[model samples]
Structures are given as structure tokens and as C-alpha cells.
Target: MSDALLDIRGLTAGYGDVPVLTDIALTVGAGEIVALVGSNGAGKTTLLRAVSRIIKASGSLRFLGEDVLPLTPEALFARGLVQVPEGRQLFGRMTVAENLMMGAYRRRDRAGIDASLAQTFDLFPVLAERRAQTAGSLSGGEQQMCAIGRALMAAPKLLMIDEMSLGLAPIVVDRLLDVLVAIRGQGVPILMVEQDVFAALAVADRGYVLEHGRIVKAATAETLKSDPALQKAYLGSDS
Candidate 1:
């Protein structure tokens, strides 16, 4: 836990008087992929927003050994903390290249941004081919790719993706997961919120099962894979 890249301690966050997350504690170490899995409205997205400082939160959030709760969203992003939000929120009217350019808005190093763009294109070749096309015209999978590419344009150390597989076909999800594995291979730590428990756990090093804004289970991916009780609770039993 001391070596964690992102650490949250007793994090309680919500909107005004309406509380959504209760005493949520989680951590992602260097170069590790951790999945936060739960049902809808279980506060997974709210937790991510809290970590990114998009929502008011109470508790300690430390990133790379520095206190992160005080930082603004842009400041947090500048410090290599980026989140690919739940919906692939792309500029529908802008071309693919332009959308990616938006990711580096706070950056002054044009040369570095271009180099990162090339790296992103290399990671997702489809985006390169469709650079001139409007983001709205691309398929859902392509849109997700562009969204992730836009995040990479910032050259983040910690990339948090929320529901990357949402509304996509199974085949597309599989392909996207493959790209995520490659991204992890590049040594970037990822904290993901996924609804597809089975698929998420298959690719995760470890997973946390969240319920009603609280983490009810935490286990290694292999252990969770064989957990009959967890299967019945989260994954659901065939019976």
C-alpha cells in the first residue's frame, strides 16, 4: 500500500446532502491494472469523479505520493492523472485529429504533443486512418478509441477508464480489451470501472467488488474467478 501509485483512504463523497459513496478505500500500485466492479448506481462512477476532483469529496486521495484532493481537475490532469469518462465524450463536430489536439490544451509543448499523437496513432491505427473524419461519424468502438487517444495525448501516468465496454458489441469489447492489455504492457497503471464483471476480472490483476457505495469484497483475479459465493452475488448463478 505504501508503494501504491494512487491511494484513497476513507473516501466519502456525494452531491450536496445526497451521499453516494461511503468510506471507499482503494489503491492501484505502479504498473498494475485494478478493476472496480459493481452494479449500476453503486457509486463506481462517483468514486472516479471524486478521485479526479470533479466532485466534492471528504477524505485523503494521494497520487504518486502527493495529496490530490486539493488539486483542480486541470491541475490533476497536468500531474499525469487522466480519466476517460463513462461516455466517450468526444467533440462530435470536430475531426479526429482536432479532438485529439483538445487533449493537450493545457500543454505548451507542441512538439511533445505531436510525438504523443503519433504514439497514439500507433496504438490505435484506425484513428490515424480516420483522422480527417468527424468524430460523430465513427462507430462506437472507433469513438471509444478516439476518446482514449485523446486521453493519451496528455501522456498520463495513471489512466482511469470508466465503462469502456458500455453499449458495444461483445466482439468490439474483446478487441478493445486487447488494446488495453497493450497499453498496460507499456507500464501505465489503469484503474477501471467495469460492469462486465467476468470480462473485467479476466484482464485484471486484482478486483474489488463494490455494493451500495462500499467495497464488500477484494481478492486477486484468480481467486475471484473461482469464488462461488461472489459468482452468485455479482456474476449471478445459472440456477
Candidate 2:
């Protein structure tokens, strides 16, 4: 349990009169990269939303052995739980540096925040070069990099990302995956909800397969990637 950074059991959430997620259970251990993969409307994004307190939910949601179901989104951010949402939701009018600054809105530590900013630049050198450019003017992949860098400015313990590979070239997605690995090496666990099953499983330590708002499978990355049933259903091949 000490190893677990995010422990979710029987997590049920949805919009009014419509259930989007039900009975979801998963664990993200400290410094581990976990993937949640499934088809459209499988509730992958909803799961991350619930954890980040963007929506109402039920059941036990724990972070670092403490019940976090009652925490507000602001409180969650203070606890080092941050989400880099889908679609790279950057402020189109803001410069890259201003966008990153927005992520540290909850912090008052000047030195620490500056250090985090420097770390972000180190991780994504292109961001450093384009710090003054408006986010809306950047290419798709550069926007994605800025989004992740902004999240890191929060100094998150668990970074949840949704559809990270969406609308990006394959090469860009691959580069982001490598960056995620480096972030994990620096001790930030990640919960990635990706549509690209093969790519997600390749970098994840473990993965949960969500279908129809339920978790249908949980296993090590190798097992999930090699499972004949999973391969046939999601990867478009049985091999």
C-alpha cells in the first residue's frame, strides 16, 4: 500500500442520469507509469476526471493512503495531483512561459516554482526556445510539449493525461513517450489514458483495459500487450 500513489476502488461517476464510469479499480504505484486503454466512450477520461475532482464520484479514492474523495480540485493540486487534459488545452492567447506560470497558481514558493520552471525547460528544450511565442501559434506537437511542461510546473506526484497521442503525428507521440519515461525517472508517476494501445502498453509498467465503464482487465504491460484477446480486439492483430 505504501507503494501505491493512487488507489481507486469501486469508483463510480457520471453525468446526470447517465453513468460514464462504474466499478473502476486500479493502482498507480510511486514512480510507475500506468495506462488506461479502451475504445471510445469507455470512460477512460471520466476516470481521470474523477481522480482530479473535476466531476462528482463515489467509492474509495485514495492518494498516499489518505481518502481524497472529498478533496477539491485546488486541494488536489496542492497535494501534487495534476492533469494534462486532452486536446492540449493551452491558453491560445498566452505565451508559452505564461501558460507554464498558470500551472503554479496554487504555489507561493518563489524559488521552488522557478526551479520547476527550469526543470520544465530542461525536459523540453524547444519550450525554452519558444517561451515567448503564443501557444496558439505553435504546431500540434509543440503544443503538447507545452501542456505537459505546464503540468510539471505543479510538481505533481501523479500526472494524469488523456488522449495524449490524439491528432499528433506518430513521431511526435513517440517523442512524448520518451519524455514521459524521463519524468517517471525523476519520480513522478503517470496515469495515461491513451487510445493507442500498443504505444501506451509499450511504456506503461501496468495497464487497465476499460470497456463500457468497467475495468475488464488488469495486468503487467507485457501481459496486456501479448494477450491474444487484447491484441485481436484493440491492436487489430492476433499476433
Give lDDT: candidate 2, residue 111.
99
TM-score for predicted model 1 compared with the true structure = 0.95
| Candidate 1 Cα misplacement greater than 4 A, ranges | none
- Check candidate 2 and list the clashing pairs: none
Worst 10-residue stretch by lDDT in candidate 2?
1-10
| Model 2: lDDT of residue 166 | 91
Q: Best candidate, TM-score-wise?
A: 2
TM-scores for every candidate against the unseen true structure: 0.95, 0.97
Q: What is the lDDT of residue 231 in candidate 1?
A: 82
lDDT of 1: 0.90
Worst 10 residues of 1 by lDDT: 230-239
At residue 40, candidate 2 shows an lDDT of: 91
**Tens digit of lDDT per residue, candidate 2, span 1-239?**
55588999999999877889998889999879999999998988888889988899999999988999999988888898889956899999999999999998888999999999999999999999999999999999999999999999988988999999999999999999999999999999999998999999989999999999999999999999889998898868857
- Candidate 2: C-alpha RMSD to true structure equals 1.2
